[model samples]
Target chain A: ELKVEQNPLFLSMQEGKNYTIYCNYSTTSDRLYWYRQDPGKSLESLFVLLSNGAVKQEGRLMASLDTKARLSTLHITAAVHDLSATYFCAVVNNNDMRFGAGTRLTVKP
Target chain B: EAGVAQSPRYKIIEKRQSVAFWCNPISGHATLYWYQQILGQGPKLLIQFQNNGVVDDSQLPKDRFSAERLKGVDSTLKIQPAKLEDSAVYLCASSLDWGLTVGELFFGEGSRLTVL
Candidate 1:
């Protein structure tokens, strides 16, 4: 079974601060994805890291994948109130896709 | 292009009652997925279909849950004799190709189920 673990499940950060949400999985796979969901809304795809050392960024968020370590990270730079939402990382292994427990972020001004 | 569409955004039912949710995937999408998301957790894949054929359904609770995709276009998920633990959001997703290699998924606003 593939297991995904995310750190800092609930985060409260000041606006303009920087933080990283970590996703660790127990499988060897090259495909990983990041998604964001607002309260009572559907998931919005953020980034798809397909290779080791692959990094993708959009706005204040950057995501990277390290396949050898079975780890991925979503970095938030200079967060804003609008970035407050739940973020999730999903990994695909052997045709099975597993998602980590989401990281809920709250930005305060 | 239209995104994945789901009906009955919210549903409230008594335990042991039956309920069904519907989904219409993006046009030309060959892969469809159904996920169950509980509060404070990530979405869990319950079943996946590839062009009207089931690809995976290992995680679905077979005794009380059933799903089908007809004509490789629309899908429906039905739950019979629901329990309180079954109260969660049911999400529908679709992709252009085989899901394993393509990680990008278009998701619908999930149907929230509440069992009383």
Candidate 2:
């Protein structure tokens, strides 16, 4: 069974601070994805890292994948209040996809 | 383009009752997925369909849960004799074939279920 683990399940960071959420998987995967979900809302795609060393960034969020290590990361730079949400990293293996437990981020002023 | 659409944004029922949720995927999407997400947890895949055909349903609990996609367009998920643990958000997502992309999925707002 493929499993994904995320560190710092709950994070409270001050605005303008930088933090990184780690996602570790147990098996080989061709790609990984980062998604954000707000209270009572569906997931919003953040990034798709398809290859090792692949990094993608948008606004204050940057995601990178290391396929060999079976790890992925979502880094938040200079976080803002609106960045508060639950972030999840998922790895796709064959036709099945496994997701991490998710990290809930709260940006406080 | 419009994203995935789901009905009955919220539903409350007593335990052991039956409930159903509907989903309409994006236009021309070939793949549809149903996910169950408990509070403070990531979405777990329950079943997947490929153009009206069952593709994967290994994770689904066959005894009380059932789902089907008809005409390769719309899908419905049903749960009977629901348990308190089944009180969670039922999300529906759709995407193109896996070969087209790295399995990027578009999700609906999800139907929140509360069992009393």
Candidate 3:
């Protein structure tokens, strides 16, 4: 079975601070994804990292994948209150994708 | 382009009652997926389909949860004799089957269920 584990299951950060959320998987996989979900809302795609050393960034969020190590990371630069949400990292195993338990983030002013 | 569409945004029912959710994928997407998400947890895949054909359903509880995609476009998920633990959001997503981008999915708003 493929399991994805995320560190810092809950995080509270001050505005303008920086943090990184780590996602580690048990199996080898080349495709990983980052998604964000707000209270009572469906998930929104953040980034899709398809290869080793793949890195993608948008606004204050940057995601990278290291396929060999079976790990991925979502880094938030200068966090903002609006950035508060639950973040999840998923790995594609065959035709199925398994997601981490998720990291709940709260950005305080 | 319009994103994936789902209906009955919210539903509340008593245990042992049945419920159903529907979804329509984005125009031209060839793959569809259904997932169950509990509060404060990540979405869990229940089933996956590639153009009306079942591709994988390893995690689905075949006893009560059932889903089908008709005509390779619209899909429906049904849970019979629902249990209290079945309370969760049912999310539908679709992906463009262009070989290179097999895993990038477009998601719908999701249907939230409350089993009382």
lDDT tens per residue, model 1, B9-93: 9999999999999999999999999999999999999999999999999999999999999899999999999999999999999
Which scores better on lDDT, 1 or 2?
A: 1
Best by DockQ: 1
**How would the docking of model 1 be graded?**
high
Which segments of model 1 are wrong by more than 4 Å? Answer: none
Indicate whether candidate 1 or candidate 2 has the larger TM-score: 1
Model 1 chain B: weakest 10-residue lDDT segment is B96-105
Q: Against the true structure, what is each candidate's TM-score?
A: 0.98, 0.97, 0.96
Question: Model 2: per-residue lDDT, tens digit, B1-116?
Answer: 99999989999999999999999999988999999999988999999998999889999999999999979999999999899999999999999874335447999999999999
TM-score of chain B of 2: 0.95
Q: Which ten residues in a row are the worst by lDDT in model 3 chain B?
A: B97-106
Q: Which interface RMSD values do the candidates have, in the order shown?
A: 1.0, 1.6, 2.0
The parts of candidate 2 lying over 4 Å away from their true place are: B99-103
Badly placed stretches (over 4 Å) of model 3 are B98-103
Ranking by lDDT: 1, 2, 3
